[model samples]
Target: MSRKLLNISIPVISVLLGLLAGAVIMLVSGYDPIQGYSAMLSGIFGDEYYLGETVRQITPYILAGLAVAFAFRTGLFNIGVEGQLIVGWIAAVWVGTEFDFPKVIHLPLAVLAGAAAGAFWAFIPGLLKAKYRVHEVIVTIMLNYTALHVTNYLIVNVLSDKQDKTENIAETASLRSVLFENLTDLSRMHWGIIIALICAIFMWFILEKTTTGFELKAVGFNQHASEYAGMSVKRNIILSMVISGAFAGLAGAMEGLGTFGYAAIKGGFTGVGFDGIAVALLGGNAAIGVVLAAALFGGLKNGALNMPLEAGVPNEIVDIVIALIIFFVASSYFIRWIISRLSKKGAK
Candidate 1:
């Protein structure tokens, strides 16, 4: 098969295999796999409310996947999306609640604040990686812990005046749509999905259609050669991380301004940032692919809630299925070999 067809087929096959494996697991665990999957599908698409909720979940997944995919394109491993998103959540809420600007200015400014905060957080690791040869993964991993505590402290000590959450953002900064809510039977869907789609397009344009993109890809392919060709490898590394973090921050903004309309202290990691790694891997790190992967993830996540209710199966099985899918995607090399062997046998 052509590389393009192979790229598409791998993910599709992985997803199918994952579902099959999940069914096997369900059978072993004494649950009706068919009923479980049927309920899952029903929860995701059988009702307008669930469909809207799935789209709402998808919005942030798209941005998070874009963040990881963008970094991968430039040969960067940004493990700090969680931290970047944490700071962005607070930063956006701060601007949203503190400002009295008009809707047009307030909403845009709040969103920009989130993007800027994430960029700044990501910049630290980028700068260190470029100048000191420090590994970004280590630095970003450490920063996630720091961000969690700091944001929690800020929430209790500053933003919320000893509360665990901040106040609701101003009406001007809210991304809520009453019309959409009514249409979906009060689901949390918002226009953030539009923003996520736009950002996906932006990533594609920058990486595939721009001079900067060429330089970034060149650096990713070979930094030493890129530098010899006069492309500043250091600059591209920093730029890539910054852009990736901006997308991550926008993911936080979707939650803060769209779904929750506020920021809250968390007892643990949000998981969305980490899940982005899987989405990017499963999507082959391409913009369109990422969007599709995000939708699948969203559907599974939203639909998982119904598994126990209708099929007497634990919802955690969905997570297992997702993990299986990601595992298969990551093992694409082995799968390719298997396919190649099968094809040769068929030809013989």
Candidate 2:
């Protein structure tokens, strides 16, 4: 098989293997895998409301996946996506609650606030990495804790000062849609999905169609070579992180403006950023791939809620399947070896 096909087959085979393994586990545990998965599929698509909820869940996931993928493509880990997203969420909420303007100006402005916060958060580590040769991972990991506690403190002291959540955003600033509500039986689906798709297009255009993108990729592959070619490595590194942080921040906006309509005190990580790592890996760090992977994850997560009602099974089974998918993706070499052996045996 061609190299590209081999690469593509790895994820596909991994997903299949994950499901198969789930089935084996289900049988051992005296549960029916077929019924469980059937219930999941039904939950995801059985009603218009469920379908809409599935899409809503997917919106932020696409952005989160893209954020991680963008940094990865530029040779950065961006472990601080969680923290950056949190700050962005609050920033957007602040704009939404504090401002009074036309929808045209207010909504976009709130969104921009989120992107800016995320970019600034990620920028710190990028600057450190480029200027001092400090590791991005270390700084980002610390920032995650700082973001959680700081945002909690901010919610309690700066914004609300009286409650765990901020005031509701004005209608002009809200992504919530009466039309979508009417269509989906009051599901929380919003226009955030549209924004996410646009961001994906933006990433694709930048990475594939511009000189700046070429420079970024060059720096990612080999900073020394990029510098030798007269490109400023530090600038590109910082720019990459800035762009990736913007995407992460946009993911937060989806929650603040679209999903929840307000910023609440978060006691812990949202898991969205961490899940993005798996999505990016599964998608191969490509825009279209991220969308597809996000859809799979979104469907699984949304549908898992119905397991108890429909299949008499725990929703955690889906979690196990997702974990297994990531495990297989991480163990790509072993999977490739198995595929190679199978291909050779078939050839004979």
Candidate 3:
């Protein structure tokens, strides 16, 4: 009972500390923290449109968070989710634009293309790690740049129009839903949120109810022990990366098929992958936790835009708060210590 309570209390305390620290910063800067917070809440929940937009924004974050969390649970660091997402986006766009098929066939094919492209891109690093003992972090980081340039080259030389963006995907290949639009008061929210939720459930099931999951987690906990126990650590590593990249790729599909119906040439990283790390960490790398954490992040990001307009606070202050939250989350040892001390005092 105490363990479960501690698990819950630690994150809650960390969040409160982060918010308190942010309030202090705002006070020091001569801004009203209460007003800023009130505006932020209102912006997030003011109407159906804002709520829908927040959900839409969180759709990708949830998938990306799951990707990172899945890898983390398997004792791997997948920093290349951004690269996988890029390649997946291009692949989805390519399929959506080039294919002529029925809505059912085309949409699924485009989504699959995105997932396969992401898996393939991640496979390279996984293979290198398995065969040559290469560090996945270094390989994935470098691959991010490689994926960016390669996707850009393909867009410029092969897939793009005069405007440096891919042609709009066919409507039949889109995941947008008029019904959802009407329900959300004309926000960009789409059927992709359904897919994201399904993926979260799928991730939870895979991790909690499967023999393969047990082996993967065993390998993660102790590779040597897992190997001695007849588990294949190398195989698990490669498989973990592949699955992680697939989730990230699905996130890319949400952008291509739902948000934009086209792929734009990017100047740099999308930052979604980087944000996934924070999401995974704050969520304790658990599947359900990732969903909740992603929603919070999505709300913050959606609400930040209104801070300056409605509350006379700089939007960048939200970024500072987010950074501080990450800091507090990373310093979880301190929070745990405090909790332990409190528990001991109560027992005494």
Candidate 4:
């Protein structure tokens, strides 16, 4: 359908425009645009090491993207993923330290603790929205602060070590590396990628093939109508938020249990939760789309480090390019016009 073509065209055009804009900026800054782009390309796909890092970076983005996309499907703006992630990270770390279980049990238990904590954090906003008619946007946004401060306080006072970080988690609590250390030769790629991919597929199935997913979508489209039709609007809203938070929590668990091998206190809020908004938008709120979008973002982010060295361009150009791409994609009127013109030409 033309409509589908337009949807695809818009993003493709936006990306081209972003690259062109980046070139312009590079010229203005007295840098070689060609070299800059070449560097970025090489950094991502040139070697197995960089490729592995790209995958590593994509792992969290996938979960974060899913968190935001899931909320979008439910017509809720869950801006509290940062809060949920922080709580998840803290809970995971705490459990890792306090318990002494075998490897199989301990790892899963700590990850589950993180998910439970994140779900609890999300439940607050969900409850308020369902019971008191509170706006989810406001509640979730404010909860980000609550999570940040509470986690910070706990880390500083209770979890802090002599060096200001909690002790490293035992091997039992960590996910065994699949390819990071020796196998990958210093690359950070790990089994988390597989888990993230599985989660994405699971979400796609739930959203596209399940009865509960339809109910949630129905509530999202028209809560009042759903209520009249005997569907419990309140319950669906709460569940959606809780599930959204759980995905974010898994992102945190990936960081703590898979990447960091322990939780380190964040001196301030990490922006991964907020960045998830951009990821969701770029992904078009689809599970597969989110995975691809996350991979693109991860490449840009990871490759930025190598740009300065190889291209003599500032890494900040990647940020600018991303912003432009998002702006153009969001404002798709131009893309529609272009597609319309092309279609008319073909007809002629």
Candidate 3, residues 224-343, lDDT tens digits: the string is 999999998899989989999999999899988998899887899998888988888888899988998899889988998888888899988888888888998888889888878877
Evaluate residue 198 in candidate 3 and report its C-alpha lDDT on the 0 to 100 scale. 92
Residue-level lDDT tens digits of model 4 in 78-190: 98988898898889888888889998899889988888888889999999999999998898889898888887777778876534567778788876475466665677787
Instruction: Give each model's whole-structure lDDT.
Output: 0.93, 0.93, 0.89, 0.85
The clash count of every prediction, one per candidate, is: 0, 0, 0, 0
The TM-score that candidate 2 achieves is: 0.98
Whole-structure CA lDDT of model 2: 0.93
Better of 1 and 4 by lDDT: 1
Q: What is the TM-score of each candidate against the true structure?
A: 0.98, 0.98, 0.98, 0.95
Write model 1 residue lDDT over 10-63, tens digit each, in one string.
Answer: 999999999999999999999999999999999999888999999999998999
Model 4 CA lDDT for position 211 = 91
Q: What is the clash tally of candidate 2?
A: 0
Report the C-alpha lDDT of model 2 over 114-176, residue by residue, as the tens digit.
Answer: 999999999999999999999999999899999999999999898996799999988888999
Better of 1 and 3 by lDDT: 1
The stretch of ten residues in a row with the least summed lDDT in candidate 1 is 1-10
